[model samples]
Target: MRTPADFCADKDALLVPAVRIVVRIVGVEQQKQGDAHVLGATEPELKCGPGVDNDGYFDADTPLGPYYLAPDAAIRLLTYDEKAQRMGLTDPVPVATLRDVLKACKSGKQPGTPYTCSGGFFHAAMDTKGVITELTEIFQS
Candidate 1:
């Protein structure tokens, strides 16, 4: 278990910040830990600092990026196209695409094929704990 001092030290390390990435979750599942959620995606994760750049898979060993979201993590569900427009993204992944994929995953159905779509991303600490401190989901007006 992490002691108070250990937690505090982790918090302090965030001041310098490590890395934040935008991950499009194609699937989600409750982890055995019960306190965390596992997210899977087909596309490479993108770094969300300074500029969006390729960050590779959350699991470098595998082609699919499977990441864990902390129990207290914040989650935001919003319209991807709208968020993309606001971000001045010329090409935006439609929310419907991600929705369908997630739906299939939840229903124990494999997606017909892999495709790229936009939903939201979480800022993770360098610790690899995959804790999301805050998240804001912006929807269409």
Candidate 2:
């Protein structure tokens, strides 16, 4: 199993193009009703490269890969009810409520803990300097 330590070991090594990285969530601080003010997580890992479909939603033959991480500040949080109807959950759940859900995910006290309502996968567009210029959420789960 890959751990945060693995990702932190060589942050530069994981930046190769077509390589997908998976980051683990450490904490979340919701700013607005739906916007994640600050989403903290561990570094990323070289989870997989091109041609592998980690999530079934993508076409197996597609070249694009998603980098999984704690949703950045750009992400909008959705409520339990809103998330259930995945067509588009625009309404933001309260930060306190989201904290409860995140706590449950971490504590494993509730069924279906470690929930996706708090995180998402992004299709990151990096610049020549390897800086992420744009991160579009391809999937929220």
Candidate 3:
């Protein structure tokens, strides 16, 4: 079984195991693989906001990895309904939210707010191949 530490540059380096991480979507790049195209994660060009001290969070300006979304990954947009005391309402409107978020980020315009950059941020679990297996939208509290 591969772990998050495998994503590190050094193979023998000791690192903590991480199953999930919050990441800022800067943009996406499509590359042709065989007969199909695959989208890879992209990072921002400049540092333009205050830094957070979260361990597994990757800001847009961090320029972290060549992470890719798995072909069969589960992607969902979640919103908390205050009255319902629940999050991740099964709404169809936010179904394509992730794509829109990436599109806005790729446009090169600053997001209206720091946390809501291009709508919202995401927390995902990546496999050893640097492929995101699960991606879920998260809102700032």
Candidate 4:
């Protein structure tokens, strides 16, 4: 498996502070080209610190960026049980593949769904169109 650091190794990669938050999904809208899903939230409330179980923290004051998922973005779903091993709680297992996650996010619009999104290190790259070309989630395990 490629470590999170590997994703951001590119010279042009930008490191952004990821914050853990519980969001009551207000709405989920799909892009016309079927390339992304825009998640609408009622102001995400901080669930824990920036890291897993509040073990580590990032810039708490950093504002939450755009709430959306790129179709090709790397999605890692770390379960509570899977994180019990040496990999740590932040180490996520790929339950729903990236494609499935994107599909779910697009079609599954469960308003008021309480979702816990942990903050991790996100290595992102922006394209000339101001769109995210790559996004990798790196949780501190």
What would the TM-score be for candidate 3 when compared with the true structure? 0.48
Find the candidate with the highest lDDT and give its number. Answer: 3
Query: Which sections of candidate 4 miss by over 4 Å?
Result: 1-29, 39-56, 62-64, 67-69, 76-84, 88-117
Writing each residue's lDDT as its tens digit, candidate 2 over 12-122 gives 773355344333333556445543334454333333344434422222232222222233322333333344543332333344544565567576554132234434333
Cα lDDT, model 1, residue 93:
34
User: Over the stretch 4-92, how does candidate 4's per-residue lDDT look in tens digits?
Assistant: 33323432333333322222233336677865766443332223233445333333343444466556544433223334443222233
Position 128, candidate 3: lDDT: 80
Off by over 4 Å in 3: 1-18, 34-60, 79-97, 104-119
Clash counts per candidate, in order, are 0, 1, 0, 0
RMSD of 3: 8.9
**Residue range 1-141, candidate 1, lDDT tens digits:** 111223233444432333444344556677776556666743332223233223121222233466655555544333323434433222233334444655764566654433222233323333345454433331111
For model 3, residues 1-141, the per-residue Cα lDDT tens digits are: 122222223323322234565555554554567321234443422112334332123235545656676656676655444565654522232224555555655676542322123234555676886567766654433
Q: For residue 107, give model 4's deviation from the true position in Å.
A: 20
Which should have the higher TM-score, number 3 or number 4? 3
Worst ten-residue run, lDDT, model 2? 55-64
- Flag regions of model 2 displaced more than 4 Å: 1-23, 28-40, 46-75, 78-88, 109-141
